[model samples]
Target chain A: MSRLLESFRIALRGLVANKVRAALTMLGIIIGVAAVIALVSIGEGFSAYVSGELEGLGTRTLFVWTNRDAANPQQLTTADAEALADPLACPGIEAVAPAYQQGATATYAGIETSPNVSGVTPEYLTVQSYDMKVGRFIEQDDVDHRGRVAVLGSTPASDLFPGSAYPIGETIRLNDVPFEVIGVMAEKGSTGPMDNDDVVLIPLTTAQTRLFTVDTVRGDYVVSSINVLVQSEDMLDSTIEDVSAVLRERHRIQPGDTDDFQVRNPSDMVETVTGITTTLTIFLGAIAAISLLVGGIGIMNIMLVSVTERTREIGLRKAVGAGKSDILWQFLIEAVVMSLIGGLLGIGLGTAISQIAGSALDMQTVVSVNSVGLAFGFSAAVGVFFGIYPAMRAANLHPIDALRYE
Target chain B: MIEPVIDVRDLTKVYQMGEVEVHALRGVSMQVMPGEMVAIMGPSGSGKSTLMNMLGCLDTPTSGEYYLEGAAVSDLNDQGLTSIRRHKVGFVFQTYNLLSRTSALANVEIPLIYGGVPRRQRRQRAIEALEMVGLGDRLHHQPNELSGGEQQRVAVARSLASEPAIILADEPTGNLDTRSGKEVMAVFQQLNRERGITVILVTHDPDIARHAQRIIWVRDGLVERAEQVGDRILADDSQGSEEDKGQAVAVAALDASGTFEEVAS
Candidate 1:
């Protein structure tokens, strides 16, 4: 320990001897470490942003859409929805809400606006992960009785019912027929290319009978899209398979013929998106790691210069009975110290940069503790790796030659 | 009757500079007893430095038997040579080679550090060594802060710090003024007389050589003459001794007459 302390003192003295040169040499290391941290953090933030956007899609929700024969363009129906909701055939399937969407004009207080209106069951809120801020979603009684009721998303509610005190319970005319607003959905931020909280919801029966009135609905009453809620995430695959099999049999598709419905597993979507994010994070990390490599090279360069500058000192120490290992360790310690300092400074700078980016750009920046560990570990390894040549040079110097050096 | 502290028998040193070999020490043999003060006097290029280097264990002779306190130093490796240099010899270079950045006290403590002395004990010993050389007040002063005389004194103190059996000084007073040279010579004489440290000094100055109890004059890598002064003269009736005595008397008379040719002859 004393020898180690003495080595530190000697190294410090060497650095002190050439203050400007040493500080300048440390600059490369500092910048490199900081770059590693900052780049990785930003990459992490980007990935986090992507994952949070995916989470907006909700968990345990499955999307069943019509698998159009690119040649045929077939739509799904209410019969397919009923088959998907069969409890005995598809156990653990919670609720099946079929959706039909159409662009239609909504009127309130002499003002008219065209918005996308979706017809769905009450279970649609849970399946699509919607929370109502005021009033209630379209219920089973509303669907059975074909009541002329509607639910507004936050944006459409404000747009259609301007100056109204709480748009809920107000009547909004869809295509000139008055429908009472039963609920207003809470705001859901943009996910990828979709603004989820910018539309209207009404009972499927009401939308079918009043809005797009066709008594004997053809093709699919469900309008080619259905949202399925499974009892748990673990039962999702089986539920999808069960739903697909029932839809195929209902559509009368023979074996080897393409089915008319497409099952989109939300978990699979999450996995694919998460995989992409993870890969992107790693790619960014690898780029950031280049800075670390540069930092290591900087350490090695500085150590080599130090060895050259302290050649006489090394000789003196050896002449005074210090062994080869002692000289080696002294130089090695100096390199390690330099790299560690750089690593720590980099981490601090990186975190600060990440925080600034998170607030300024409205990104979700997450600094994992493991990344810190990895950065430090990498710095230490760099110290050892870069220190080897200089340490060897110092250790190999002859005492006599060193003493003779001016 | 004391054992010889340094015993060199037919020591020869050859230096290979490119292709030509320079025989620095062709064949040199000598002995210095404990407490003896000996001076090696020669002209420039007389190989005095090479001989001094060998005695200091800083260089090995090409072929020789050098028994320093009965241990063979000629065959020792680098580490062994370092041990011999550290524990058995203290060297005072003509240039007063003190580390410029270190204080006088710290410079004196260097050998003790190499000797594995603990910090506190080494400091105390260094201070005592400085005091012995009358530089106790200049302990904290660096080599550049001190005069040539004081720096040499610090070097002397450093030599004494290890408590070695032999003090090897290569022109210890060469760089000093007359007064400082006398002062340094006085210290060397005192140390030899009081501490019983064997002193072997190399010098081209005859005045400096006069301070030693014995003088070994070297010419062309050979010990040309050895003279014992003070109390080593023996009362003898041998013819060769009588002739040497007559020559000595004639030289003394010429010195009284102040005749350059007579003294030179």
Candidate 2:
């Protein structure tokens, strides 16, 4: 233990004697480690934000899409959504909020911009777990009466009514059709690509009867997709089977035919998206790890040079009684201490840069403790791996030859 | 009779530098008793340095039996030789091979550290060694911070710190001025007389060789003569010698008449 500590002291002295060279050598490891931690932390933060948002929407929820068979044009309707919501027909289903969306320009007092306009039922609020910032959402009576009322998300509401205090009583025109703003939703911010606040919601009956669709017929209607909530996470597989069966029956698909509709659990989507992101993180980290390899090579290069420069010192130590192993360990410790110092500094730098860049670029970055520990441990391993050859060279130096060295 | 501190019989060294082979030492045999101050004197390329290295255990002899304090060290492996060098032999180089950027105290502590001395004891021993060398106050000063003579003194202190049985110095005063050379020689004499430590120094200068009690003169890889240094002027040049009165008077008179060539001849 004392010898190890003495080695550390000697290593420190060696580094201090060649501060410029040591610092320059350590730069490689510093930058390599910093890149790894910074990039990985941002990746972790991004995934965390996404998964957290998904969890907010409930993991057991499933989205059913039509593949929107363009040739057949078999779009969904409110009747189909109601059919899936029936407990007797789809046993594991709890609620269904079917929605149709159109990208349109909304204007209020000449402030016009493109916003997503969604037509949904009263269960949309419960299914989405969204709360009103001010006024209430559209009620069942509004959907049944085909009321021309809309609930504006925070962004469109603020943009169209920048200075107005009473946006709930104002009228906002969606594609030249004016609708009274009945409520303003609380801001949900951005989750991945979807800006939750930059949207407007209206009743499905109003959207179908008045704003969009040529046919006014209610029985055979069209919607983009349906959001189904499973009764329980354990019941999800059976619920997907039940929902698929009901859809198959409603669409008149035979036993051998492949269904045109796509049924997906959000958690599966989470896994797929997060899987891609994780792979992307690993790919980027691997690229960053290449720099660490380069850094290790730098350490080896410097250590070799150091051994040559300190040849006489090694000889002197040997003359005094130092064994080959002692000489080897001396140089090896110098290499490790160099990189270990760099590794520690890199952790602090990487974390700081992560936080600063995160805020500056409006990105969410989380520095994982695991990545910090891993980067540090990996740097030490690099030191050992790279230091051996030079250490061996120092150890194997003949005392006579070394003493005779100028 | 007690075994000699250093016993070498027919030691030879062959140097193979790439394709060229050079025979540095053919066959040389010598011995020194305990508490002896012996100087091995030779000209450049006369193999005295090689002999010094072998005696110091820094290099193993190619063919011979070298018993250092009764241990056969010439046959020992590199590590075993290192252990011998560490525990039994101490070396003083011409350049005072002190570790640069290290304090005088630390430089003195090198051998003790290798000897597995505890930290507190190592410090204490180093302090005593430095104090013995008359650099008691310069303990914390690094080599660069000290003069050449002080550096050499620190080297002496380092050698003495281990309390080895034999001190093999290759041209100990080769790099010092006359005054510093005398001062360093005085310390060697002090260690030899006061502690009964065996000191073997290599030098080309007859003036430096006069400091030793005995001289082993080498030429062409063989000892030309092993002569007792008749009258040692080293302990104190100002005082008179009790032995070899006539020869000492003749040598001093030759020096006084400025015909010192006779002393060399």
Tell me the docking grade of candidate 2. medium
Tens digits of lDDT, candidate 1, B13-119: 88888999999887777766667788899887888878888898777899978999888889998778778767888888787767768799988877776676777
C-alpha-based local distance difference test score of model 1: 0.78
Per-prediction interface RMSD in Å: 3.6, 1.1
lDDT of 2 by residue, A1-406 (tens): 6776676777888999999999999999998899889888887777777777666656778888886553353567777898998889888887899988888789988899888988889888877777888988989899989899999998898899887656878888999998999999998876557787888999988887788873422466677879987878999999999988988898877788777788888788788878988988898889888998899999999999999888999999998898887787888999998889888888888899899878986768988889999999999999999998999999999888898888
Question: What TM-score against the true fold does each predicted structure earn?
Answer: 0.79, 0.83
Which candidate leads in DockQ?
2
Could you tell me the lDDT of residue A35 within candidate 2?
86
After superposition, which runs of candidate 1 have C-alpha atoms over 4 Å from their true positions? Answer: A66-75, A102-107, A110-116, A132-134, A144-146, A155-167, A175-177, A186-196, A205-218, A222-224, A244-262, B1-97, B109-122, B162-187, B199-265
**Reference-based lDDT, each prediction:** 0.78, 0.84
